[model samples]
Target: MTEPLWKPSTQRIAGARLSAFAQAMQARHSELEGSDYFALHNWSLAHPEAFWQGVWDFTGVQASSPPKAVLEHADQLPGASWFPGARLNFAENLLRYRDQRKALICLLENGRRRTYSYAELYREVAQLAAALRRMGVGPGDRVAGFMPNIAETVIAMLATTSLGALWSSCSPDFGISGVLDRFGQITAKVLFAADGYFYNGKTCDSLERVAGIVKAIDSLEHVIVVPVVNERPAIEGFAGKHYAEVLEATVTDIDFAQLPFDHPLYIMYSSGTTGVPKCIVHSAGGTLLQHLKEHQLMLDLGRQDVFFYFSTCGWMMWNWLVSGLASGATLLLYDGSPFAGQGRVLLDAIDEENITIFGTSAKFISALEKSGQRPRESHDLSSLKTILSTGSPLAHESFEYVYRDIKQDVCLSSISGGTDIISCFVAGSVTLPVYAGEIQAPGLGMAVDIWDEEGRSLRGDKGELVCTQPFPSCPLGFWNDPENKRFHEAYFARFDNVWAHGDYAEITDHGGFIIHGRSDAVLNPGGVRIGTAEIYRQVEQIEAVLDSVVIGQQWQDDLRVILFVVLREGLKLDEALQQRIRKTIRENTTARHVPEKIIQVTDIPRTISGKIVELAVRKIVHGESVKNTDALANPEALDLFRNLPELRS
Candidate 1:
């Protein structure tokens, strides 16, 4: 086994909130006398009810009615119920703090910065909640936002949830069809949108798309337009009021409606690469409890910390980032391209704002590395301590670059979870050692395990990543899935009662996890299952390669690996470069990992969230139709893969 890349010092571990929580647990429960993270995790999984109840008390979750039962039908995975008799408001807990301290700090690509104090945030939410109420938005009504990641977006969501109405949002970058696919299914009563948004130093107007969406979705009775780019966009055709006008109404206080534990709080959607996105409805209490556990205990976030995540309103990370408010930490919101000013925009924000915990995707780190931007050498990242990465698996080379080039002392947490839960199954730990290319440990109270084809548990081997127990963050159900048939087929189909998260992963010797890739995108060549990330890890190491995507092509009654490379500008894939690519893959991995064919493409298709669409590319390469090209950021990139002359050979 290799040595850990980084380990928390005695002082760091002792100062961590996780250590304090463990000590508190030891004092409360006799079985949790051990102080290590592994011991605490085991105790948590063994007694989930007591563990969750302890989290609730430790976090001081405000509730009108406490849970009569912590968990019911614990053995049933999808059927299990959590917090049986609890009545709590998700937005109220987040808005619990109303001091002079800063609650939200909004930043834009055009060097515009705004700060909202906790008290001011409360006032805005109150005003917006009043406006929404006047607009006839009641409990259980769907309220959607098609806006940028600004303070107003957060305020609107808080206001909607405060009234017990469900909230959903997508970034302005999404096209009309993508927005309609998500909001159209739920049929929201109110639509909040921005006049325009800024990206890559350019302004993109959204009124045209907003107009089309309102026309298509007949359930929208009111459209509230926020003046982001254009202060007063023409709303002559739309039946709505300006965002400022709505907040200026006569309203001073907010009345938070107490709802059941299982009441819908937010509706997250699947990637919908293959089909229409599934509207996964998450519960208020579950999202709150899970995010609190992750924020307070796992990430060790506190009132003094400043949290920043580079996310759009569409992604689930935005939802996760807002929960920092409940932790009493100041939340940072950035809207625009991270590469707007040659990648220095985000790096500058880290130093300017004294950001403590910075959250981003793996691709961003890789891009920073490829761009030859050394933040540690040029920027003052003294206040930065923890770096959280998700969206995809973090490469081992990227991990090395973090400790070597970014910061040696920081905790580089590679977290993995999806919109299905709105929280991580395996995330970082302040008390544990950080191994290269591995998540520190399974989240506390998450019974994560690796299962084989026959539903048998396995360790130290690559298999399906399965959660053997129910967690608090599980979605209530699908939006239109009346019988829960879609929900069951989505998660519980592979295993009898286990939640089969569609990821190929392995449990490491250090009690960590290494996620290979998506299980559905796993390549089976010559009857051997190979993870696409294995090839990507090697290919990305080449200096000439900017990006690459691999897929399995069916040929001669067997599958063959086909690799597509997006080379750097002014570089071409020649015979020598092909040999170098194959040599790198064969030397680092086995010969089976080498691609049978290497083709160079201009761009790779990805979703709005920056995840490469492997399955969609595979379908197009095999002369099959891609169901929804509208979900992709570069839908035209699919045309490059279709009818390729090289594939015929």
Candidate 2:
């Protein structure tokens, strides 16, 4: 029973909704098991050409010229070109339906709300496209947005694509340096941003950061300011215009620029821990077809659903969540702190908006669980059908917490993928049964496998997570990296042609999967494999600590787990606190999982994007150089780690 494959329970998802034309091909192969999802998955992988071609045809994706085949280059994973010679615009596929159906639910930090219908959204995007065109925006040019997750941000992205301009963005919360490290690289010609944004009870202004970014990036030609809270700032040396004024003299029929299938639809960057940020360019056609498969078939997202992902414009979740509109679902966009004023802000939004698909990070979920938050018991969350968790590995305890404390019947999907692909390697499928702590399967088209240190395949055992071939979402290449050296070094260098995602995971007997932690983040105590998330699952359950990070310190030729905790407000980390942390972990996990030393710290270093920097902290504690402190939000925090009395032997 404990094999590397499991069958979905009764009432599985129907086979891909193939067109009559494609069905004839299936008919030619009568031996194929079309009804079984796994059978279909294996068949697609064996014939990658026919699988993607079917996806393009079924989605009705508009293209200027259909390609002769699905892939032009297959043997070379890094050089694969999907739908070669095809020309399509990403915004056109997203804006297909122009009826009065509600396209978006615009939310504010406070009590204000605004909704846009499909027709209204189209009109606004057209005006913005016209506005950008007047500002000298054209094909292959960069347009950046420093804005919140609201109507204008989505409009700006759509509008940029409409004009065949590349769209890139950062959330308003990004500090000047963080935003500059990313946006400064692409050399944006036009910038669209909000003056200020509200979160919790306080208003946060972006004017200063915007000014600094504009000053640093010499290519910025114009700034279009959307006043969300405060009056717009008057910055010198830049041509400025109001968003409303830009839309004033524009018509609603701006044409969608026809570009090749591989035209850059969006530009996203990697966290620059090692060096300069790598700008990942995605395609218009690939993004459209892939999102369609994820939304319509996997997620079953429909117009009846009102979706919301608690994310900022900077995160890829924002990119994924906004694509819900392409499924004709009303996406609920909230601009504020997710956990504000008692951690009930998102719950209130869910109740008020009746959000059907509510997504958040695993960190947020674990925090809520630790806080003893029971929104299902207190608030009305009946509208939510699925709860999605990602960013980090969602622990087994977190999975159990959702079913036991949050909602018993809701589908708890713990998905994992990253900025590199701009999509998921493993995600949810409503047609499949929910299991505790496991992602149901490798996303249908993904050829995901588990490999050990020797590069040999290992199933039903913890190993490295890898993908075998060129998936559509793979970044074309790193920007300014002419020889494609950086892109190859980042993913393919580990194992030639195979994408080493650096995640410690196992493929379960039932074809389900479990993520332990980042292979890089694993703690080796006495040379035993220990997932950092395992300690986190147990440590956060202690009442005194708000958060903690476990790192392995190399001492006397073996690794030891040293825990640093941030105590809850007004709490002291004394002997009693250490006892509680150790006891909790030992009782819940194993003896090796418990920390050897428990220390208190003011804060843990994280990227501006909210990823914990375990490697950074480990470097500091071991008296090694933290190669790039510039990537950290609080670089000065490392000073406390150095010369610690406890570190000296």
Candidate 3:
């Protein structure tokens, strides 16, 4: 059995919001008396309606009308309707706080910082919402943003949703085609973009990309340009108003439109590594309630906490992080490379701002460890209490690094979910123990389970991660998927009414989950199923290795594992290092997990969100056409794997 990396003390557990909520629930329900974490989780799944209602009441959700019924058609997967009689605006809940306390702290890479009080933020949102209403934006209309991670982006989203418009956005770093692929599908009426932005100490102009995108997306009526880098860039060709001019003439009061519970609040996109991106539409009530539950109960976020997640506007974490405002926590937004300032930028921000809950990716942690930067030695992170990691599976070694090198007393949680639901199915709980390389527990009211090939639920074996019951955060459906054929094929095609979440996972004996990798990219060698993350966990332990990707290649009428590595600068893939790589993988994993072909590459192709695209590379190596090259951040890297002499053998 693996020892826990960190465990909450009796005082900490008693102080957690989860413990308080559980105690309240126990007082209301006799069956919940003396329920532990696992028992409470099981009860929540069994009585989802009661549990979700409790979440609403405990969070004090601000809705215009209370729900007549908790859930309708509870047995149906995609058709389950939650809070049928409720009416609410997503922006209303987020803007509930109007005090003078700090709400948002904006930081740029070039030593620029700004702060917004809750009252100031609400006034700004009201001004923008009024401006949007004057432009004829209304309910069900789509509005898009091609901007950086800044205060204005959040303001724009809030204003749009306040007018009952569906909001969608992509980071300014996306190319013209990538932007078109997403916003083009939904036909946004208004498009907001920055003139330019700074990244990695360079000012990257967005004017040219914006020009190309505006021309491609036909439904765009108004193009609002924000002067991020330049005070006023050349907007000669485009026909629209400047963001400043629009806001300057806006009124102070906003008329927030009250919509149905299932009104479309956001349109999130798939990674689109394989093909065109799917616009997954999420509901207003569902998004608000789920975020409230995760924020207040699961994460134990509150007013005094300073919350920060390293993400671009395009990533879903940005959406997740912005919801912190609803919990009355101060949001810290940063727009630049995390590696800026030689990786000390974010660490310095933590000390300066007294960040309480720090959220970032697993890759960032590994990079920090490899950089030999021990934050605890130089920074005062005493204010930090919880560290959240996602984007990819956090390795066990990274867990050790967080406790040993970062902060030992803090809770390190490796959460896993996707843009598909816009929230996590399994996340960390403050009342639970933190184990190495394992998510603390399945989220309350989420029926997360691991299943075998025959659809039998398994406890301690690796299998598909499935959600048997319907949850509020499941997307309303995909855009342009009128018959829901695409949505059905995407999630429920694998099993009957069960959401096969495409994750190779195992429910540990401790009631935690270990997500191996995406099931589509799972490696099968000699009829033995293997996860790519299993190999990556071992291969990344070598000091000489910088990054790696593993895949199963068809060879000799049987599948064989192949490994590709991006070695550290000035290090070559010689026999000694190759032997070390193979030995490390063999000793940690099984012999079959060792790669038959150990190749070195200068780069690994990843998606724009920093996720390694193993499926796209697999298609490239097999001489198949990758359907969407625009989906990749570095598409040219695919050529490195093409026509390789080593693959011929």
Candidate 4:
């Protein structure tokens, strides 16, 4: 393994931001001590009550009563609810600080850009909320959207949540079946969608699919089309209103409906690896406190900083990214392919927006490196103070590439946490130094520890990443999982009470962490265990490859590496290319890195949210049945892996 490029620096927090947190507390009439980073982090883990109570104050989290006490039931893992008696509103906290500060910046793929200030956003959200109320939408009713990352999407989410309604969303790229598979389960009375979405120099229309979905879902009685990508579609058989029709004449005074703390704030669905996607319900107060801790303490996003996380409307990262609004920073939205015009479009956006905090997936960084695209060479990225990476375990070489090609003196935060919690277990810390191949620390109040296969906790060793103590962010429970069977089966079944996040990780002796890969995706070749990322790190760094997926195919009661490479457009996986891949792997990793056969494909299968589905592909190669394949972007890609002659027993 290569040494880390950047470690923690001496940069300290400023008073103005800290003062904002303090003011938020005072306005809510809550009591919290003035504690520093490390001190408060340890304190929170030790005293869970005091920790969450502090967040309730720190973020000015409004509640009707004092919880009836915070956390009545802490012993029950899945049933444990925070601030059960308190009444709060998720959107209220987000819209608390209303001023002339730039709230959101939308950069469309069609070269159209629009900026909305906090005042403007609040007005739109209020007008839309009133329209929904008039449409018979109330608390507990679900509102769904097929949208891109833009001001209209945020406004819709905020408006829906403002009415104490459950909000769920997916990107426009999701097909009719894909949308139906997810939205089918949730009872969304109102469907919000765009007339079209622009991506890769093309304007794709969603109206027909929106109409199709309206016919499919019995609960959907209304549709609202936002004119973002193209002109609004003509109203036909569907009884709905365009966004302009609802909010053109805006009302300014937005009254937030306060609901119980445990009220469902969002209805985010699972990727449905096992079966149909289950709706994961997040609470109002819980989601607010958790996101605040992540943004302020972990990421340290401030008003001076323009925060941007490259994400679609579908992913949980989009929800996480949108919370930057509560932090008073300009939330930069890029609603299209990162490589739409150029591979460096996002990097160029950072320069244009003067974004202090920039975020993207690890796959994007690797792709940039593979394409030999240098952003630093072409653009001035000095305003980029920090770079955030997630969605997959960042390869160490990708780590080196960030410092060498992206920025040197910036914090490269590789965060790990997922849909299960809606917050990070192991994430970045403002006070800590940046390490090239590792995440700096476990998030504050998150009692994260590494555990071995035996369920025994281990330090300075790689094992299943587990969180021992109960966290505020753990999903209340899966929606429609009446007996909590799926919820328990998903998380608690692994190590009883501990949260087995399904990632293989090691806490460094120096207090950093190195995530190997998804624990379930670990490859055991000839009894020697190796992370899939280990192979990808070496294989992707080569000049000849575009992207590759390494899976362990079961053969003769042993595991063999079977690699599928999608070469750079016209490039083919020739003998010389295969040899170069092998040489690169052997140099960077072990003999296990080299695959037995390198298969070529036109495209790779990914989830609607853009994550490579290796296990599904493995099942396909083994001739196993794939259920709910609608979740895959390229479901036909799985067919290429089946019945290969080289894999004959």
Candidate 2: stretches off by over 4 Å? 1-31, 231-238, 583-591, 624-642
Model 1 agreement with the true structure over 1-649: per-residue lDDT tens digits: 8999999999988998888888888889998868888998999999998899899988889999988899999988887889888899999999999999999999989888899999999999999999889889988999999989999999999999999999999999888889999999998999999999999889999988998999999999999999888778888556767999888456768899998888899999888889999999999999999999999999999999999998888899999999999989999999999898877988898898999999999999999889887888999899999999999899999999999889999999999998999999999998888888899999999999999999888986899999999899999899999999999999998888889999999999999999999999999988888888888899989999999999999988999999999998999999999999999999999999999999999999998889999999999999989876768889999999999888887
State model 3's lDDT: 0.90
lDDT of each: 0.92, 0.80, 0.90, 0.81
Cα distance off (Å), candidate 3, residue 521: 0.2
- CA shift of 39, model 2, Å: 2.7
lDDT of 4 at 46: 71
Clashing pairs in 1: none
TM-score of 2: 0.93
lDDT winner: 1
- State the lDDT of candidate 2 residue by residue for 1-649, as single tens digits: 4321223334324432322323544775564456445666676788888777766765667786778668987977788888887878889888887889999998887766999999999888988888888888999999999998889999999999988998898888767777788888898999998888897689887777777888889999888889888545564445578788888455878688998888888898777664667798887777777887777666768778899888778888898988887778999998887777588888888888898889988888888887889877888788987788888777777777887778776777778888888888888776566676688778767899999888899976888899998788878777778898988888888898889988888988768788888898898887788888778877767778777778999988898889999988888988887898899899988999988888888888876556788888888888888755556657777776776787665
Using Cα atoms with residue i matched to residue i, what is each candidate's TM-score against the true structure? 0.99, 0.93, 0.99, 0.93
**Cα error, candidate 3, residue 358 (Å):** 0.5
Q: Model 1 — TM-score against the truth? A: 0.99
Segments of candidate 3 deviating more than 4 angstroms: 248-250
Model 4: lDDT equals 0.81
> Residues 115-137, candidate 4, lDDT per residue (tens digit)?
99898888888888888888888
Residue pairs clashing in model 4 are 6-434, 7-433, 7-434, 8-433, 8-434
